[model samples]
Target: MEMCNEDKSNDDTQELSLRDKFSKLFNELEHCEKEEQKQKIEETNRLMEEMDKEEFKSFIGYWKEMKCVWSLHFGETSLSKSLKKTIIDEEKRREGKNEKLLVELCECYLFLINTISAELMPICIPCLIKVALKKEESEEAQNEVETALMVMSSAGYWEFMEQELYLNEIKEIIQYHQEYHNLKRLAYQSAWQFLINRLFNDNNLEGMIVNELCFVREAARELDELLCCVDWKREIEREEVIALMRWFQTLALYFEFCHLWNEGYAELISIIVKAFRASRDDHREISKQCIHLLRKAAEIEVIKINDLLKGGAVDLIFEEILQSTSNGEILCDCLNFYLMISRKLKRMEDFKTYEPKRKLIKKEIFEKMEKEGYEDIIISLHETFNYLSKEYFIHLPINISDYFVNV
Candidate 1:
């Protein structure tokens, strides 16, 4: 009985020792200088590695509890003030080492987010934002901004939108990045996260997000300039081309939800059609995005059939279908888009509007399909037309497939 009591006492003492070690580590991490904090992080990692998995998990839980209590006591405002001062001091110092220190400081805050209280968000968010929005032209500064944006993205906090000034500052940064070809990819990623978070929460920022920042009225003009500048045939490095295409695709997606289609529909369609035609096999991803955006535009009725035909979208669609016979997904999308066009034209017949122009375009499309040896496409369209005829009881002014069959 005495041995068992002694064993229990030993276990209690060991548990207390472990608790003390954890508390010491947390306090050191919280209050240490940036370099010391990094060392503490390494120490903490080593300690975690030495612990059993279950013990380590328990330690994490305890750490989170303690951090939450600390955050509540110190408050987010106080934390933000301290962090802002550190950032300003680091910026003013302009030492090469200061960049690393700034990143480390930001990382510390990022790590704290896992345990930080919601009320502390205002403090943490603004600090990261100021760091991201700081106007330094150095590569390190760019990296810092990217890192801060990445950290903010990981937090996935839409509450930042509540601060109008901060939100606009972020928007301006995104807009500024959009003008530089090299930085545009990160800009797009940041914009996507920012816009999507707000969209998911149903927060509207329509009036503030405009042409140069989000959607440009002269998208076609810009696309044409890009095409002229890039010799798609000779440009073996497809990264820039692909990135530009993705930027346009993201813009189309953003416009879809915002009902801002009229803002750039014509230009978007024109650019997508051109991309579909110019993209090489190495750029199959770009081609796929083009098809996806086209399909989306068609489904939303953002790009009218007339506009599509005017943009020669049908010709490009048939070209992709013929070129990608073995690509089942692309083939499927092509067939689906063809069906949408047919249905749209059939609906237009109700108005007896542009009937001749529509018939002429349909004849031209099927003729091109037959000439291009898209017999499978003709068969699919024939089947689809018969099904639609029976389902909708709509009469075709002309036997659509008959044109393909005769050709």
Candidate 2:
């Protein structure tokens, strides 16, 4: 037994600890021992053959059992020491042995088995997510979450439809993960990535995925879930864990806008914008999280148009722009979210629907611009109006100085 987990408290997790487990599993693989190694290799070959069988039935049960054992036996520090001793024993038995080659042989066998059979996945993925999240939890949770989320988003449904078997296994992993909130979220993300991988292979599925909006809804919902994890009231540093989760959330932001166009989903997106906004006051780093998500939303055309609208819950955008302007340097963020909003407001109405709303919007935008002392914005708005329509924007800017001059 190798010491895998330093934190004994997480022992209840089925994959126990990860540290010394894989190396030990590799070292102890009888396949490497001259006499026993032959038998184990033969057995592995038989298993591999069976994996390609007309009735590849035993694999599911074997992998399930493997998951059970690995989860329970992994990652205990004490276990790590035991495994280290095993390594020493194995090394001593072959005094003139090449450690690197032995390690490589073990890894190759494990890797081959892991890839050909889905068995290792049930053992590995959840634990992989766990360690990744646990390690990046602090100062970086958001980024970790985003990375995970992006993977899932890219996975989508069509990918799973093709790789149905792997997808099914992933579902099992998801079930195991659901019991733990962190894993549940990650599994959701992973499911999406699995689909994304498939989408690349098939254009029909890709087109269909694009036509439907599952990616959009799931991405926003996931971001909300990840962002909700930040409870600033009780401060603590689990940088490893937080970093992991943050990374996951960052991925979610990418998938939402880059793939699904979350900016089109006004209600949920506003919440994302606002939620990130509330955190800006706590720490500057958190404020960056706010900016990341907002930039994601800003990337879409629909959001850009909607940002200036007063109704359909568009007031939130205005409030966000104003609140952000007051929050601090975040206003100067790379996305220039505030600048986007201001530019939209300053532009004269382009479409018919926009025409009706332009009058009141012009007044409100002018008010905010002057309040912010953004004179360049006035010139830009005037230019925008000229490009769109001489008539639509002609009246709005003439009164810009008057609006500022009077106040």
Candidate 3:
């Protein structure tokens, strides 16, 4: 009984010692420079390595409970508000030092999160995101959001972060901050991290992750809006054109991967056709992206390809684009679009049900391409496509083929 009492006393003393040491180290981490903080992290890692499994588990539980570790002493909800208020009210703003404390606090929080086990992420991530989603465009706020996105993008947390709710959070972040380049880039990284894992590993794309949360249809809507709102009559700024080109590439990726096709896709094709007509002569890069997206859209017949035929998209390509541009890239994409059309025409030629599509492609695409002196390219591509179709088994969903019968 005496030995038991002594053992209990020793345990209590060790607990106190750990608490004291952690508190002291936390404070030092909060104040230290970057290199010094790295050293402290090494010390912390060594300390963790020295503990047995049970001791390490107990340490993690205690570490998670500490408010200072999260930099959320006033609570998670109020941390950003308080920091913003401090920046606004402080005389340190005049010296350009107002954000110093916030930066240091973010660094300390990052350090703590990096050191903690990924299993503890549920507790850590929500608080980090609360700070990250700070509506301000301040450098410190950007830093916080970037760090959170980087952590979310990292492979270690992907198993937990791939949940639908978290993916929605990433989408919302992107939807809200379309103007901030760094934020958009990192947010896209997080979103792709979730997508690429599910795509290659599971090979399953059912549920909201693909249909709604994948942002494919949503991106089509946004691109449609961008195309409609741009003043095509005037010379667009170079940066604006470049940004538009990037958006085109992004939407192309969505059309390639996400298979769900809706009315938004038809609208996207119509608007892109219009935008292509306006930009093809002036912006080769944008024209190329538009044609490339059209080719991808053609490959996946999940959507109504009739929309492209009806929109006079083929006429615009043959009449204006081929006549105006000498760019090899633009010509290459144009030829690819023609090749895709030929393949479609070949597939539908034998079926009486697809006679309307056959006539439409013949009139809008093949005749026009032949008129434009692309007869040899068209004939050779068809021969190649015919051989490949016979040799290769292209598996498509039954529903996709059924859906095409009506269009």
Candidate 4:
């Protein structure tokens, strides 16, 4: 009987020890959760610092192993899933209570992915995009899209571009939405990054970029809509105008290298001419961008002189020079564009195989220039040349008298 009593006592002791161990573990986990929830930045820093320790294999592995703990804390297993749940819950919360919790949660996720490892971005990005694409168009939805775009903009990983669904969804947002300028701006920036990556970083995607999907065409179409709808006169539209111009400039700058300039040439030249003609003191920055784009296109020979003249670009250029002769930058760009056109004309005239059309083309260019008041261009060029020559005599030793003999 004593032996039986001793056995029962031992069993009771073991069961009590097990209960204490569980209680200690539970408390430790709770403390960790509170610490992480309250001090995400600190916790993230701690995790990153400890990443090279012997215990943690890698940042990604450690985060994956913490899935269960995260599930217990946030009621979702994966960070992506947790983010989606938080967005939904925040939307359901009372208007007053919907504070910045969603933004905080999203920012935390963005920070983690941006700082630690973007290996998980493929999973996280899609979820964020879905939230962004919700048709509700509520304040919550717009916030979600904005946050998602912010996160996407931070990720430099190129694999995200490989996902057609992801790219298509972003393209849709940029194409259709005119209200969310911030979201649209970010989307355009992100798409530009993706294109840069594909063109410069990933060599394997060249064939796909050329044949499978032409982003240039899509970007051009969206730019057309922005130009058509935006009221450039409004102060509120300034940022949007700048964003659109930057996007158009990027396309004009790089599309030639991609051999996709033909896809966007006509539309781009038309828009650039319109922008240049619309230039005023208030819109000087956009005018500069338009001129910069024109210079890029002209330098690359993306559009012929005849094509530019036919598109009314010559008149616009001369007009810009006539209006802004005192503006050194405008004068320089206009002169450079004219010089490029003259060079192209000379090249055509010298082509032995195309000699038959050279005289006709030359006559056409001269008549167009004369019709658009070429005398103004010559006067502007002469004044600019003389002014610059005198101002920078040390750098410019040419004889202005001899240089203007032809004019």
lDDT of each: 0.56, 0.42, 0.51, 0.52
| Clash tally, candidates in order | 0, 75, 0, 0
**Least well predicted 10-residue stretch by lDDT in candidate 2:** 60-69
Summed over model 1, clashes come to 0
Best by TM-score: 4
Q: Estimate TM-scores for all models.
A: 0.54, 0.42, 0.49, 0.55
lDDT of 1 by residue, 1-407 (tens): 00010112436546544434654675555455667867776877777677776566443322332122233222233344576567556655744645556655655555444333454455556667777776677786765675566556544433444644257767766766656543333434544455544543453654455443544443455555666666666644433653465455455545465544354566667777887677745567667777776766665654676667666777777777666342545655665677677766666677776788778866776677668777665554565555544454543223544333432
Clashes of 2: 75
Instruction: Please write out the lDDT profile of model 4 over residues 55-115, one tens digit for every residue.
Output: 3322222222121112223222244455656655665577665444554555455534333
- Once fitted onto the true fold, the runs of candidate 4 whose alpha carbons sit more than 4 angstroms away are 1-139, 150-193, 203-217, 261-264, 279-281, 324-326, 349-351, 356-358, 372-376, 386-407
Question: Better model by TM-score, 2 or 4?
Answer: 4
Cα RMSD of all models vs. native, in order, equals 14.3, 15.9, 18.0, 18.8
- The sequence of per-residue lDDT tens digits that candidate 2 reaches over residues 44-86 is 5555554444234222222221122223222233333344444
Q: Which stretches of candidate 3 lie over 4 Å from their true place?
A: 1-161, 171-217, 228-239, 349-352, 355-407
For residues 193-241, what per-residue lDDT tens digits would candidate 3 score against the true structure?
Answer: 4344444333345345455454555455555666676677787754356
Pick the winner on TM-score between candidates 3 and 4. Answer: 4
Which stretches in model 1 have alpha-carbon errors above 4 Å? 1-125, 150-166, 174-185, 207-249, 347-376, 380-407
